[model samples]
Target: MAGQTFDLTDDNKILSLRSPKASISGPYKVVFKNIEERWAIVAIDWDGEPRLAIRWFWGNGGNPFSSGNPTWLVIPSSLSNATLNGLPLDFKLYSKLVDFLAGKITGDQIYI
Candidate 1:
């Protein structure tokens, strides 16, 4: 954790993640996946700093700025307001944002 800055950018894609009981090593993994629609999110606490990678499928007849493939982003959760690809944290993502800010993983806390 020496050289790892707290910046939200620079997603290392290293999906290998650490569980509370497991040690984090090699490539890290995710928090959750197959999110609402056209989007998916994964989180990793690199050396105890929580971060998320939001991926979205831009299947819009090949957008000019992109190849129309799913794009991945590592954004800031510390800002007063956060936006994903210029989108507000509203709509279906609102609930997910709440969980992210509160450091709660809803899917992992459920008891069958």
Candidate 2:
């Protein structure tokens, strides 16, 4: 959880962290699946591979930035379409996923 910062810049939007033990060197693409509950997913490139850093279900009581709780769900690039926590990444999830990857949204904020 050390050396982590939220990036909300004009040209870049990501949550980055610099830590030796970090799963991925983030400049991660973040997506919010259930905004009301603050459930989100982050896509990160780790060692030349794509992985999902996700929190399947989180509410106001949960904090995504924390190193503890709501741990990252690392999905291999090949298994991206596979069920995560028994649920498939459907169209709605795909829409939000694309938006986040495209930098159209940052965190829970939607660009106007």
Candidate 3:
């Protein structure tokens, strides 16, 4: 493939959903990965899709789920609290995002 390559750069935390779930979806799966540790799932998106963003987090007393540093809740860099470190994943988002996309909800600039 002449034009096949990998790219990972975005400002919005969007988790593109997939079937069979993934590292950040389902009832039990490692949402966070590190050199030695892996965390379990803490939530699921609407429409039942898998989260694709993998968090490389080493666990000791805390987990990614509890830390709440989600890469799936984008609200625009101009208004986000973690603008510098908001690693938007282009993956799934909170169920609210689904509603927002379907016109079932409304907001300023939140996305998934």
Best by lDDT: 2
TM-score result, candidate 3? 0.19
Q: Per-residue lDDT for 1-112 in model 2, tens only?
A: 2112222232242353322235555535553344454445566645534455654333332344354533455556556545344445556666655564455654343222
In the range 1-112, model 3's lDDT, one tens digit per residue, is 0011211121121223222233233322222222234322212332333222233223332322333333322123233223213434234544444344344644332333
Ranking according to TM-score, highest score first? 2, 1, 3
* lDDT string, candidate 1, 10-58, tens digits: 3343232122223222223333433234343454443344455554433
TM-scores of the models, in the given order? 0.31, 0.41, 0.19
Q: Give lDDT for model 2.
A: 0.45
**Best candidate per TM-score, number?**
2
> For model 3, what is the C-alpha lDDT against the true structure?
0.29
Q: What is the lDDT of residue 73 in candidate 3?
A: 28
Collision pairs in model 3: 14-90, 14-91, 14-112, 15-91, 15-92, 16-90, 16-91, 16-92
Per-model clash counts, in order, read 7, 0, 8
Winner of 1 and 2 under TM-score:
2
The regions of model 3 sitting more than 4 angstroms off are: 1-47, 67-112
